[model samples]
Every structure is written in structure tokens, then in C-alpha cells.
Target: MTARDEILGRVRKGVGKGDFAQRKIDAQAWLTARTRGPQPALAGDLLERFRNKAESLSSTVEAVADRGAVPAAVARYLAAQNLGTEVVMTPDVAALNWIAHGVRGTARAAADADRVGVTACFCAVAETGTLMLLSAPDSPATVSLLPETHIALVDASRVVATMEDAFALLRAERGEIPRAINFVSGPSRTGDIEQTIVLGAHGPCRVHLILIGTSS
Candidate 1:
């Protein structure tokens, strides 16, 4: 037997299994019957709320009119920050016309030496200003983690109300979950050093978001 079978056999023997398939059904029923607990009234414009919360978490947000303007926006942000025009991107965003805008986008994994990474998030959470990324062949986890500067190009329509909404959307859309789901809230930071907060301690120090589907 494989390692999985071996471990599961031991579990079954220990637990004295009796209709484990029914248990699965019962678990699904329980999940379906579950209701959300009390949460804050997230009233008003979702985009405004998301932008405010993202900025509060140290993430810079920029709104563009449409997807066609994304490459130019990326170029502008890099130029302003003095970060080079060369950025690594996920395969989903690699097909963009980066060359026309004088920016080079490499569809590959990012390294520590890589300065900026351009990625499109699966969705952006308005509640906590978190970015939900479902990892796939086209969307690797390293592209967003290793780089010093992370530039996310997200559609404004994909911004959800809460963390629960994000997960609900995931379940409704993707049948089989991706292997890795990354939720990025601004840039990586830590406060372990003498109770003082430090940014870029573990990941990208700068997170610049290009929010599409809105007026600039």
C-alpha cells in the first residue's frame, strides 16, 4: 500500500470506522447549514472601502480606467519609484504588451535579487484589504513572494465584501481548489523586533496595486 493508504488504514483501525461515507455526508450537511456570525455593517462603496483599507495597511492603490491602461500604469509606477522597468509576471499577465510600453515582463519565478513582480490577483478582499491568489501553472506563488516590490493588477469588479465572500466566490467558481491559495495583505511586515514594526521583513516591502475597472 502507498503511504497515504497505510496512514489511513491505521486511522481507520484506531477509530473503528462505521460508515465513514455517511460521516462525509453529514459534514457537508453541517457546512451547508452553517450561518455567518455577526460582522460589521460594510455599508457604502466597496471600491472606496477597499482602497482606504489597503492604504491603511501600507499598500499603495492606483485606479485605471480599463485593462488596456495597465501596462502603462505599471511603467509609470516603476519609473516613479525608481524601480527598473524589468519585472517578472505570472503567465496570465505575461501576454500583455509590455514591450510597447518600454517595460519587460518575464514569465518566470522571482528570485531574491528580482526587484519587482507584476501579478494579477484572483480577487481582492475589501474587508481586510487582502489579495486572494489561487496558485496554478500560470500563477505561481513565488512570483508574488520573493520580489522586493509587488505590483498587482486587479479588476475592480473582483473586489469582494469580506473574507467569507472571497471564499464563497472561490467555492462557487473553482470546483477543485488550487494547491496553494495566498492572501496578501499589503506588504510583508513584522513587529517582533523590540515591539517596533518593520516592513519587508519576510517578503516584498512595497505592494502597489493597479485597480482596473474604475476611473483614474
Candidate 2:
């Protein structure tokens, strides 16, 4: 038989044996964490330090206080990159006035090459310095993935301590249901074979984050 058939036959045989219980327990243990520790005070100092560190690691890092607070930052970025008004706007971004900045927003279903993609983040992690996006009705999954340049507006209030914290928040909101959740760390990068890091391998080459901070 062919290699594919052999693999399928092995899978079928494995299923027939019903060896799923052990694996399930192992998976649960891997995901579940039981910990008791003192919670550190999350303050502006901490966030600024985190932002500084992230900037040091990454060549590109932009920060803002609120969603509405930084329309000029968006304009500056677009002007610097020379992106036009034809931008693919996701419904998730409610605060930013795209038209005011001379940007044409579009629904997720009808995004095209001419349009730059705009989307909102469900949560931003301060630990790994990543942005988390969930595939909800307003935040269509494609906006973050398809465009040549992706501009994400992250509210500082939504920024969490760690990836574990983000997961906890997600579990509280989503429950046990499995859905498309993307965790983007910087832009899309690949350093395979030749070992030279290259950006925009399968996704957007440029990822500009607008960190929108707010009072708690």
C-alpha cells in the first residue's frame, strides 16, 4: 500500500484499540496549572518598561494612550509607508474614525489587495509582547492574515500580564468551544534552511501596533 494508506491504516487500528483516555488526561494536565503567588501591582511604570523592552528587541514599536487618542499616529504611519485611503477595515475597530484619517474601511468579507487591513485585538500580552485576535463576527480572521500590511489597535486596558493570563481571559469568555484564535508576535517571520530571518513569509510583512492606553 501507499504511504498515505499505511498511515491511515495505522490510525484506524489505533482508534479501534480505544487508547484515548490516557492521552486526554495527559493533555488536561499539560494545560491546567495550579499556582498560588502574590500578584504584582500593574501600573504605568510596569507597562512603560515592558514597552521599552519590546522596542529594544523589535526594531518597530509604537505606543499610544487610547484608541481615539492617537489618530495622528495612524496617519503618520500610513504617510511614512505611503499607504492610500483604500484600507480593508474590520468591524472590531469602533473607536477609530477611519474616514477622518482619509482611510476607506470595508467589511471583512470583501477585503482586497488594494485595501489595508485594520482590526482590533481581544487582548495584548505584556509578557511575550504579543497580540491575540479571535475570529469573531466583527473581528474576521482574514483581516490580520491576508493583507500586505496589518495595522492593529490594541487598548492598553486589555493588555494582560502573560500568555497564561490571556488564556485564562479567553477561557472565561469562550468556554470549551474551539475556535480560530491567532497569537501574533511581531510580524510574520521565518528563518528556515539558510537561517536568515525573513519577514512576511505567509502573512503580512509589516505589522504596526497602535497601543491605546486608558484609565482603569
Candidate 3:
């Protein structure tokens, strides 16, 4: 037998494996059930809670009317921050005419020197002020990680009351998980040295969120 097969056989023998096909069927059934554990009681409006929590985490947030207005809002933010007009964005928002707003958009993974990276979040958790991002062909993980500034476009409708709710939505929509799932709580910070918090230690120093839709 091949080395891989031999190793697997030994492992199965030690573990006393039954029908592998049956085990896979069981796992699929468990996933489809969408079972959830206990979650904290989140009071008040979910959107308001999300905003408050995100702000507390030092993430800048803006409420825009709709998706059509996102490009203009993003442009305004970049100008106000004195950032450049060129930005790396995800393929999901490629159709938007960013050039009209004086911002050149490139749909690809972020590079080390990239100043700004824009992406649409899969969902936001209100309880912890966390952004749920699932890496896919259109949404790359590097867009939110390898940039000085990470700008996220989140639909207010996708904001969940808790982390549990977010996972439920993911299971319902995706059925299977993607290669990478990122939960961004705030700007990357580290207090390892002298217990002094330093931003951009491992990732973006700034995280800006543009909330869209009527609920926003």
C-alpha cells in the first residue's frame, strides 16, 4: 500500500472505524440540522448594537443609503483621510463605477504595500462587533488583511444579533464552509511589548465599515 494509505489504515485500525460512507452521511445530516448552542440575550436593535460595539472596538463606521451610494461614500472617506485614490477591491463590487468617483479599482488579492483594500462582508456579529468574511473566488481574505486600511461594505440586513446567529446564516446559505473564514473584530493590535497596545502589529491599522441598505 501507499504510504498515505498505510498510515490511514493504521489510524482506522486503532480507532476501530466503521463504515466511512455512513460516517460521512451522519456528518452531513448533522450539518444540515443547523444546531446552535446557547447565546447571550442581546437587547435593543441589532444594528445599533453593532454600531456601538464596532465603534468601541475603534472601527470607523458610516451609514450609507444604498449600494449605489457606496462608491461616493468610500471616495469621501479616502479624501478625508488623505488616502490615495487607487484601491484594491474584491470582485463582488467590480461592477460599481469607482472610476467615476476618482478612485481606481483593482479586483485582486492585496499586496504588502497596498494602502487600501475594499471588500463586502458576508455578515456582521452585533454581540462582539465582529465581521464575518468567507473567502471565495469573489471575496479574497488578503483584501482585509494585507493592507494599511481595510474598508468593508456591509449590508445592514446581514447583521446578526449574535455569533451563533451568524453561523446559522452561514450554514443556511453556504451549506459547506469555504477555504478560509475570517472574523475581524477590529484593527489588528498587540500588547506584547511592555504591555503597550500597538495597532497594525500584524494587520491593518484601520478598519472602516460602510453600512448599506434601508436599515443602515
Candidate 4:
């Protein structure tokens, strides 16, 4: 048998002997021993530190609610660019009424020449102005890719403290294992060739975030 198959066979045999529970207990004990310090509270200095870290990772953070015709603003921004009003919007964005803003929509990845892309962020980070979009049925991640310009509509309520917090939330939603999770910090950019930072090298060059807030 292959080495991998033999290893799996051995694991199966060991698991049949009820060793998995003992292993789990041992692992838990090891983890507890490693983290013996008391947990910090989520306020004041701790919160400030988290806020600072989040800002460093995010591109453009905004705080807002889903109300206030935010979708209209997204559409207006696209129209102003004379980009594709008939954009391939992410499924999350399609849930909103883009009709009010005079835009047709699709979920397909836009071509490089396409004018605009609209998407709803799964999370917004207040510390560093960043939006997080995860690929799913309603939010195809490719919508954020493949476009020249991308517009993200984020709700203030969805803002999180840090990437760690964001990953925790993602793990909760996806269980201990996930297929593909993409974390977009800002517009796709690279300064590799001549050390001259160029945007839209591998993905959308421009990223505009529309923060829909009940109280900014």
C-alpha cells in the first residue's frame, strides 16, 4: 500500500481503540498549559490596540448601516464612471434593489475594461478602513477580482475589531474546516517590477468603499 494509505490504516486502527478521545484530552491540556495567562478584557487599551492592528491591515474602513439607499449610492458611483451600469454584481449585492439606481446586474467576473463592480462586504473593519468579502452562494468572491474598479457596500454593524476576530467569525460559520476563504486587504496592487507600486496588477486597481451608516 502507499505510505499515505498505511498511515491512514494505522490511524483507523488506533481510533478504533478509543485513543482519539485521550489524544483530544492531551491536546487540550497542552493548549491550556501554553496559554496560562488571564484573558484581557475588550475595552480601553486592549480595544485601542486591536483597533490599531485592524487599521494596519484594512484598506479603507467605513461605519454605516444597510439602510439609507446605500445601493443607490453604489449605483450612482458606477454611473458617474460611465462604467458598466450593467455590472456583474455579487449575489450579496443583488439582494439589494439596484433597480432604484438604474443598474443591470450579473454575477460573472467582469472584464478588465468593465467600468464597475458592486459587492456587499461580509465584514467591515473600522480600525483600518477595510472590507472583507468571502466567497459563497450570495457573494461570489470573483466579483471583487476581474474588475477594473470595485465598490463595496458595508454596514457598520458588521465591523469587527481585528483579523483574528474576523477569522474566528469565519471559523464559526465554516466549522473547523473551510474550502477557500479570501481576505482582501485593499485594492489588488504590486510594486514588484521596479518597486513602483501599481494598482490593479492582478485584480481590480481601484476599490471604493461606500459606508452606509445610520450614525457616522
Report backbone clashes per prediction: 0, 2, 0, 9
48-158: candidate 3 lDDT, tens digit per residue: 999999999989999988999999999999999999899999999889889889999999988988899999999999999999999999999999999999999989999
Candidate 3 weakest lDDT stretch, 10 residues: 13-22
Q: How high is the CA lDDT of each candidate model?
A: 0.91, 0.72, 0.91, 0.65
Using all chains and alpha carbons, the TM-scores for the candidates as numbered come to 0.89, 0.73, 0.90, 0.68
lDDT of 3: 0.91
lDDT of 4 by residue, 1-216 (tens): 999988998988876654778787887577546633353344544333423443454434343455657667666666666675677777656666767777777766556665667787777544444566776777777778877777777665567765556766765776543445666667787889889988788987677666566434
> Against the correct fold, how does model 3 do in TM-score?
0.90
Tens-digit lDDT string for candidate 2 (40-60): 556565456446545543525
Name model 3 segments beyond 4 Å from true: 1-11, 14-19, 30-35, 214-216
Model 4 TM-score (2 dp): 0.68
Reference-based lDDT, residue 128, model 2? 64
Q: Model 2 reaches what TM-score against the true structure?
A: 0.73
Clashes in model 2: which pairs?
65-213, 87-116
Weakest ten-residue segment in model 4 by summed lDDT: 45-54
- Give each prediction's root-mean-square deviation over alpha carbons: 4.1, 5.8, 3.2, 5.5
Write down the RMSD of candidate 4 (Cα, Å).
Answer: 5.5
